[model samples]
Target: MQAVFATTQISERAAAFLPVERTDGFEERRYLDQRQSEYLRMLAELDELLLRNAVQWYQQQGRNADQWLSAVAAARQESRVQSGQGSATRRKSSDVFSRARKLMGERGFPEDQYPPKLVGFTPQQFGLERVARKGLERLKWELERYEPFALSVYSGATREFRTVNAPVRLPVDPLSPGEVEETCILTGGDPFAAGERVRPGVLSAVAGGAVVQLPETVSGRRLALARWIAGADNPLTARSIVNRVWGWHFGRSIAANPNNFGSTGGRPLHPELLDWLAAEFVDSGWSVKSLHRLIMSSRAYRRSSRPADAADVARLDPELRCLSCFPARRLTAEELRDAMLSVSGELNLQVGGIPNRPELHAEVALQPRQVMGSFAAAWVPNPLPAQRHRRSLYALRLRGLPDPGLEVFNLPTPDFSCERRDSSTVTPQVFVQFNSQNSWSRSLAMASRVLRETATEDGAIQQCFRLAFGRSASATELRQCLQHWRDLEAVQREAVFRTPVPPPEVVRDAVEENTGERFQFTEKLYGMDHFVPDLRAEDCDARTRALADVCLVLLNSNEFIYVH
Candidate 1:
C-alpha cells in the first residue's frame, strides 16, 4: 500500500488537456511491478483473500489496460454515488458529465462535442465491455460462495489495495434531477417546498447573540461547530465534562443534574469547588487522568464514610455539604456481574473485539424476537465458557431484550444517555441475585475455588470473605457461617443427586406480513450443544453443597453489593 502511494503522481499537462486523465502518475515503472508482487505476498499471508478489484486490474494489464482501468474506476465511482457516498448536489448530473468527458477524451474526441446521452455509454469503446461483464458475473458467483478477494489499483504515481468479500459493479445510470429531488424530499426536505430548503448557519441564540457564518459542506460545518465547542473562550464544555466525571465517582454531581446546566437544573451545591475543578481540568491540557488524580488525591476525597462527629455534622450540615464523608453507593449492574465472575475465577479477561454472547436467562434467550417479516434467530450464548464468561461490558446489548440479570439490577435502557442509574431496591433484584442460574453457577464455582485453595472450614470461610468483601470475616460472622454449613451438610447427607435437565428446543412463531400466514421455526441451541456445565448440588457432595450454599448467601449480602 505504501509503495503504491510512493510511486504515483498526476501529470498536470494531461489534467489540463484531458477531461478525465489518469490521476495517478507512476514515476518508477519497475516499482509498480515490485509493489504488486509485495501486495500479493501480503494477501498470501492472510488466512484467505477476497480479491474484488484485483481481478479487474489483472485483466486490464493485457490489452489497452489503461483505458480498461479508467472505465473500471468510473464504474466504481458511479457505484459509490449510488450507495450514497457522493454529495447530493454534485452526485446527480456532474458525475455523469465528468465520466462522459473522460471517455470522450480517452477516444481523442473534443470534450465539448461529447453528447450528454453518452454519460450512459457502455465500456465497449475501451474494449473492456466483455471483460467487465465477465468479471462482474464471476464476482456474483464468488460472493454467493462467501469467497473473499483482494482489490488492487494503480494510476499515474499511486497504487492501492483492499480486501472485500461482496460483489462490486458499475452504476446503470446517473441520477436524474427528479430522482435527486425525491431523495432530498425523503431524507431532508423538498427543495421546491415553501420555507423547506435548509441553509447552513449557526443558531443566533447560541452564537454569542450573533449569527455565526459556516461553510456549506458537511465536513466544514462539523469542523466549525467542533471548534466553537472546544474553543478556550467557551466556558461550558470543560465545566460540563468535569461535572459528568465527578458524578460518576461520587454518585452525584456538584451541579445535581449533570446532563442539564440550564435554568431548570439544580443549582451547584459547591459552586467554587466546581469552578476550580473546571479551571484545573482546562489548565492540565484537558487530561482526564490529571483531573482524576487531582480530585482523588484531595483530603476531602479521602474522608471516612462515618465522620468523626456524625451527629454534630448531620445537625450542622444535613446535606453533608462540607465533604465530611464519602458517600456509599451500590455497584452498577456491569460492576456487580463482573465482580462476581472475577471472584469465581471464571472471568475471561480478554479485551476488545466484537460484542460477546454471555449466558442469558433461558426464557429471555429463547423468546421470539421480531425482525423484518420474520422472527429473528434465538439468542445463542458463545459455545465456549471463556467467551461466554467475558465481562458484562462485552455482553451483546439488544434494544428489545436486555440481559434479565442486568435489567433486574437497573441497567438502564440504552436508547438515551444515562447520567446516573436508578438504585431503587426491588424484589426482582433479590430473585436474580439468589435464585437465577447465573448466580447459583457462580456461587458453586466460588465454592469449588475456596475448597481447592483452602484446607479447613475456617480457611474456606476466610477465603470466601476475602473474595467477596476484600477482608476476613469477623469472629461472629465466621462462627455463624460454620454453623450454617454444618447444618446444611447434615440435611443434604442423604439427598439423592440428579443430573440437570437441558434447556428445551426453542420454537418461534411469526405471522407473514404479506400472506397473513403463521409459521413456526425451531431455533438451534448452539451454546448448550457444546456447553461444559458448571458444578451443581447434584455434582458436588454434601460438604461442597453446604459450602456453596454459604457462598450464595455471602454473594447476596450487602457487603458484596455496596461500595463505601
Candidate 2:
C-alpha cells in the first residue's frame, strides 16, 4: 500500500519525480533543491510499511484504514525522536529516502527501483514542491474558497526632470524582474496610479469640424477609431487619395502638398476641378480605376506639351497655370530605371515576390557594413538576369545604404513618407548615367537587343531611337548616328576591352571587442561565383561594341530621360 492510497501509486509517482536519471549529486546539495522532497518522504513510508505487512494489510481489508493511520502516527513519532525535538514534527525529506532504502532491501526489489536519495533537500522546499505536485489538489481546494494570485499594481520611473534645484538626484531602486509597467502622469508625478483617462472622442474637420463623442462599449477605443476613419461624414480620406493619384500623373498635385492640408499648406491650384474629382471619386464607390479612367480620358490630359504658338503660350503662362498643354517633366527615378531596362529588353514584369537585389556600385556592394558590432554580409546581386532586372519597386532599400544609381537620380528613402520627390539635376546624376558600370551594362544590352531585332546598322540606329525616345529617328539624326557608329567601329576594333573580374570573397578589417584591435575577416559574396553578368563591351564584336557606345549616348540624352 502507498502513503496516499492502498496501491503502488505513491511509489510510481516518486519514481518519475526526479527530472534526472539518478540523484547523483544530491549529497553535494546540487540536485536536492530541484527534486520534490515531500514526494520522496511519502514514498519512504509507503515502502517501509509495504515490506513488513503487504500480505497482512491486503488480507485484513476491514482494518486497512485504521492500520494505515496508525502507521503514519508511528512514522511521525519516530521522526520526532530521531530529530531530538520536544514536539512531533515532519521527518527530514532527505533522511526519509535513506529510511526507505532499508525497507526496500526486505521487499526484494532491485536497487534501481528504490526511491531517490535526496540527501540535502530541506523540509521547507519539500512543502513548496508538495504544493506544486498532487498535494496541490489540497491547496487548490483551499484557494478556491479564498484567492490564490492577484496582479500587482503600481510602477516607478526615474526622476529625470531637469527643473530640480539640487545638483544630484537621490538614488532610486531600479525595477526588478517582471515589474516594468510605467504610468504616465496627467496632472502630477504620481507613479502609483495611471494617468487621468480622456473621454473617447474623435477630432476631425468633417461634420461641423468638432470633436464628436463616441459611444462607450466594453472595449471601445480601437473600434471607435475605425468607425470614425471610415465614416461617410469624413471626406478627407477621399480627397487625399484622389490628390495622390492626380499628383502621380500630373507631376504636381492640385493641393501642391499631398501630406499637409492645414492653413500652412498651399491652397489647391484648381479648387473646382479638385472638388469635382473628389465628388466623382466618392460617388464611384471609391474606385481608383474609375478615377484614372475619368482623368486619363480628359481633353486636358491628352493635350500635347508642344501646342501651337508654344513660344507665345510660354510667355503668356510662365508657370503653365493655364493648363493649355501637357507638362514636360523628367521621369521619376523608378520610372527612369524601368524605362532603361525596358529599352534593354531585360525588364522582368513578375509581381509580388521576395525583395530583389539589383546590381549596385562596386564600392557600395563590396564594402564592409557594420551592424551592432559585427560586419554585415556582402551585398550580392541576383544571379539570374530576370531576377536582377526586376522593377525598381521590388528592389530592397537599406537605410543609410542607398544604391548609388537610384540615389543619384533622386529616389527618396523609404524611412519616411515622401509626399513629393525633390527632382534636382546634380553632378552625381551625370556621373551615374555616363560613368557607372550599371549604365554601361544597360547600354551594352540595349545594343545587343537592337542588333538582334534589326537587319542593318541604319535599322538598328532607328530601333535605338524608338526604344529610347518612343519615336522614330529623323533622317538627319539617323545619318549622323550611322556615321558616329562607323567611326567608333574602326576605333573599337583597335581598342582593348577586358572581361569582368568578380572576387569570390572580400576581406575587410574589423575591430575586435575584447582586445580593442583591428583584425581582418573574409565575407563570402553570395551568388558571385555563379553570377551571370549582363552583356559587356568585351562580350561581342567591335561593331556591337561601337553600337553599345551609341546606345550609351542615347541613354544619357535628355530626350530619353524626359517624358512629354
Candidate 3:
C-alpha cells in the first residue's frame, strides 16, 4: 500500500495541498515525510555549482533592492529641498513613510520578515521589497487601494499656468443716435431704432407663428443654427448641391437660377430627375463622390454634343432642354489658361503648397496702390519657371488686381461666389490670345515641341493638331496647315532682323490718401534679374518661327477654346 501511495504521491493530488486545512494525524505525518524525501531527492539531482550560483544570485538581488530604495529616498529628499519646502515637506514625507510601513505590516509582511540588510531602507523601498517577497496577489491589492491617490498627487504636481490678457467687454447700455450710425457703418447694417438691439431667434415667417426658444449663449445659438441648416429634414441643402453640380457639367442647372430655388426662381425643367438625384444623394450617406459618379456615368452625360438628327433639333428639343445631346460650352478663363500651359509643355502640376505668382503683364505687375501710408510692393512672379508655370488654381488671387488674360476672358470678380461663368465672345480675348507676350512665348515653346517630336513638316502639322484638339486633323485641315506653314516660312525669311528691346524701367506713382500728394518710387524688379526668358522668334530659325505662327493660329482656333 505504501509503494502504491508513493507512485501516486507526486501526481495531481500533490499539487492541491492547502496549508491551513487540518488533516488526520496519519495523513499529516505521511505528507510531511513525503515532502522531506522529495526535497532531498531534488537537492541530490541538482549540480552543486548551480546551487551555489543560485544562492549568490538571490543575495545580489537583495543588495540591488537595497541600493534602488536608497536612491529613491535620496531623490525624494533632494526634490523637497530644491522646491523650497524644507522642514514642513520633511515632516509630511516622514508621515508618508510611516503610513506605508504600517500598511506593509498589516498585509502579512511584518518588519521582522524583511532581510536584516534592508532594515534602514526608505518606506518606498520597503514597500517594493514586501511586494516582491509576498508575490503578485499582495501587490495587486496594494495598487487597488493606493493608485488613485498617487495619480491625483502626480497630476497636481505637474499642473501648469500661464498669463493671458483679459478681453475688453462692451457696455450693455443702449446705443446713442451717433453710436447707432457708427455701428451701421461698421457692420453694414440698417440703422436700428433708438432702443433696438440684436437678439437670437428664428425668423417669424419661417417659425410659423410658434414660440421658438434658443440658448442664451452665443456659441450654443450658433451650434443650434448650424444643426437647423444641416439637418436631415432640410431638402433645400441636398437639392441645391445637386443643381450646382449639374450646372457645372451642362453649363445650366435643371433649375435656371442655381442660387435661387424659391417660387421666384425659374422652375426646374426636369423636376423628377432633380428630386430623384437629391433623394439618392441623401440616401447614400451624403457622399459627394458617389453622387458625381452617378451623374457622370449616365447616358445623358455620354451623349454626343451634336444632334443625332437635324429635324429633331427643332421639334424634339427646341430649347435644348430635352437631354437630346450634350451641350458644347466655352472653357472658363482658368481652364483656358491651364490648357494652354499644359499643351505647350510649360505646365507645373505640383499639388498643394503656398500660392504661386505667374508672370503677370508688366503694367499690372508694376502698378502701385496706396496701402496704409505708403505704396504697396510691386507684384513679382516667382523666380523659377516651374513656379511661374503652375496651374491657374495655384495662382495668387488678388481682389484688387486680377490677371489681365483671365479678366479679358470674362472671369468674374472675386467679391462673391460665381454661380455660373459668362462665356461672352469678346474681341479682347482674341488680342490676349494672339498678341500678348506670354502667348507668343507659349507658341514658340509649342513649336519647338512639335519640331522635336516629329521628323517632317507633315508630321509636325499632325502633331500640332493632336496637341491642340485631342484628335488628328482631317485631310483638308492637314493640307491647309501645311500650306499656311510654307507661306509663313517664306514671309519670315525676308523679315527684318531687329535687336529685341527689353522692357522699360518702371516708375511707380501713388497719391497719398491722407495728404493728397503724389509720390514716385522706382519699383524693384527682383524676379527679372534671374529670369529665364522663353524661346522667341529671334532665338529660332526661320522654319521654327514659321512653325510658331502655325501653333499660334492653332491655339486661337475655336476648337481649342471650346469643350464639347
Candidate 4:
C-alpha cells in the first residue's frame, strides 16, 4: 500500500528528455525537480502498467497477502539501488565538485561564492504516506491496528516537517450513542455539543413472503447477509437476476421495471418463462454466462429484427409485449463507446485492469472544479494509445463529474443503481456523435487502418462499411459514397493541418485548503518527448482525409449504433 502511488519510478525513455547542462551553477536541483515532474506526469501510465498486478502476481507465485505489500516496498528499493546508480552518481559528482572548488580557489575565489549545487544534490526521502480514502474513512476499525504509521514528508520550500517523528495510536472503541449524547463534546478546549446521535441497529425488511431480520454476527455480517440472500429458501435473488438478464437480451424486461418487483412494478408478460429461467439460475449455481448462452440459443432471440409483416405484428402487440421479433434497440452508453473503439481497431482487449481517464471534451477537461476547500487537480489521460483505448467498462466514474461524450448518450449517474436508461435523441447527441473530437479521431483511425490493409480507395471505402456496419455497401450506396469522397477530397486539398501533435503538460493554480492562498503546480505530460500518436488530419493527404470523412459519416449513422 505504501508504494501503490509512489512517484519515484521514472520511465526509461524520460532520460532522453532530461536537459543538457549549460555553463551554469545550481543546476543539479533543477534536474532533480524535473525528474520529480516526470514521475508525476507518468502517474496514469505507471499506475496502469505497474503496481496494479503486484498482489495478483504474488498470489499466483504462491505468496500470501501479508508478503505482497512487502514485495512492493522491496521492488521500489531495488530500483533505487540498480548497480548502485544513485550512490555511484553521487560519488562521481562529488569528485567533479571538489576539482572545480580547487581550481576556483587557485584563481583566488571566495569559498562563500562557491555554488551550493557543486557539493552534490541530495534527493528527497520519499517517506510512507497515508493516502486516505475519499472521505478519509478507515476501511475497517481493525485496519487501524495493522496500518503503517506515516513518516515525514520534506517540504522543499520551507525545509520543515511538523509531521516528522509523529506519535502513533491504535484503534479504540468509539463512544456509544447514549454516552456521546450524555457527555459534553469539547473542541479547542471549549465545549462544542452536537445533536443526539441516532442509536444503531438493524431493521427487519420484508423479503418476498417473509419478514427477514438482518444477521446478528459478531463479525462477517456482510458474508452472513449475502449467504441468506442466495440461500435455498430465498427465490427473490434468482428471480431478480433472471429478470435483469432477460431485459438485457430483449429491449425490455420480463417485468418492465427491473428496479422494483413489488406491486408498484409493471406486470410480467410471460410469468412461466420468468419462473423457469429463475429456477435454472439457482440450479446452475447462479452462473450468468450460462444464462446468456441459454437465452441467445433460443429461436425468439435469433429471430430477425425486420419482420415479414411489421404492421400485423404491431397491430397484435402495440407495446411490443408479444416479442414478435427481436427488438431493435439503440446501444447503451458503454456499448456505444466500446463499439466505436472496436470499429476503429483502437479498443484494448486487456481485461480487469485499472480504471482509465479517457479523452474528454476540451471544455470539460479544462473546467475548474473545487475539492474540499481547494481546486481539484487536473485530470490527466494515459499517454500511450493502447492505455487510452481501454474499454468503457473500466472507465473512471467520478460521482459529480462525468465524461461529456458518454453523458450525451444517457450515461447513468455513478452514485445510483439505474436498471433502465432512456436513450432519448437530443440535439447535443447529434453534435457529439458527428462533430466531437472523439468521433473524428476514431474515424481518422479507422480510415488509417483501412488505408493500410487495402490497396485501392474503393476497397478502403468498402472496408469502412464492413468494419462499421458489419456488411458491404450496396451498388447505389457505393456510388454515392465514392462521389462523396471525391467532393470532400477537393475541399481538403486546400486545407492546412498540423502534424506530430504533442500532448500538453498542464500547470494548474489552486487556493490552498489551509492557507486560502493561490499557488501553482506543474503536472508533467508523460511520454511527451517520445509519444506515438494516432493518425490525425495532417498525417494523411487530401485523398486519405476524404476517405476518413466518409468513415466519420458511417460511424454517425444509426446502423452502427443500434443492435438491430
The TM-score measured for candidate 2 stands at 0.65
Deviating ranges (above 4 Å) for candidate 4: 1-215, 499-532
Candidate 1 lDDT, 1-564, residue by residue in tens: 112122222221211224342322122222223322333333222201112333343454442344434654685476466647643111221233345346657878554433333222223211222222223333233222211222322122121227432333212322211122111122344445544334445444445765566554322445566677787766788888999888887788889888787568999888898899989998999999998898788887787777788898788866766667887779999999999999999998876544567877777877877543234446766666777788787787889889889988889998998877888899888899999888888988999999999999999999999999999999999999999999999987988867555563566555543344555434445335556666676878888888888999999999889887
Better of 2 and 3 by TM-score: 2
The better-scoring model by TM-score among 3 and 4 is 4
- In candidate 3, stretches whose alpha carbon ends up further than 4 angstroms from where it belongs are 1-190, 194-214, 496-505, 510-519
TM-score of 1: 0.65
- What TM-score does candidate 3 get on C-alpha atoms? 0.62
Ranking of all candidate structures by their lDDT, best first: 2, 1, 3, 4
Which pairs in model 2 have colliding backbones? Answer: none
**Model 2 bad stretches (over 4 Å):** 1-196, 209-224, 310-316
Candidate 3: tens digits of C-alpha lDDT, residues 293-343: 998899988888888796878797877787788888899998998988988
- Among the numbered candidates, top lDDT falls to 2
Tens digits of lDDT, candidate 2, 21-46: 33221222211122224344554544
Worst 10 residues of 3 by lDDT: 4-13
Taken over the whole model, the C-alpha lDDT of each candidate is: 0.63, 0.65, 0.63, 0.61
How large is the C-alpha RMSD of every model relative to the true structure?
16.1, 21.5, 28.3, 16.9
Q: Candidate 3, after superposition: displacement of residue 374 in Å?
A: 3.3
Candidate 3 lDDT:
0.63
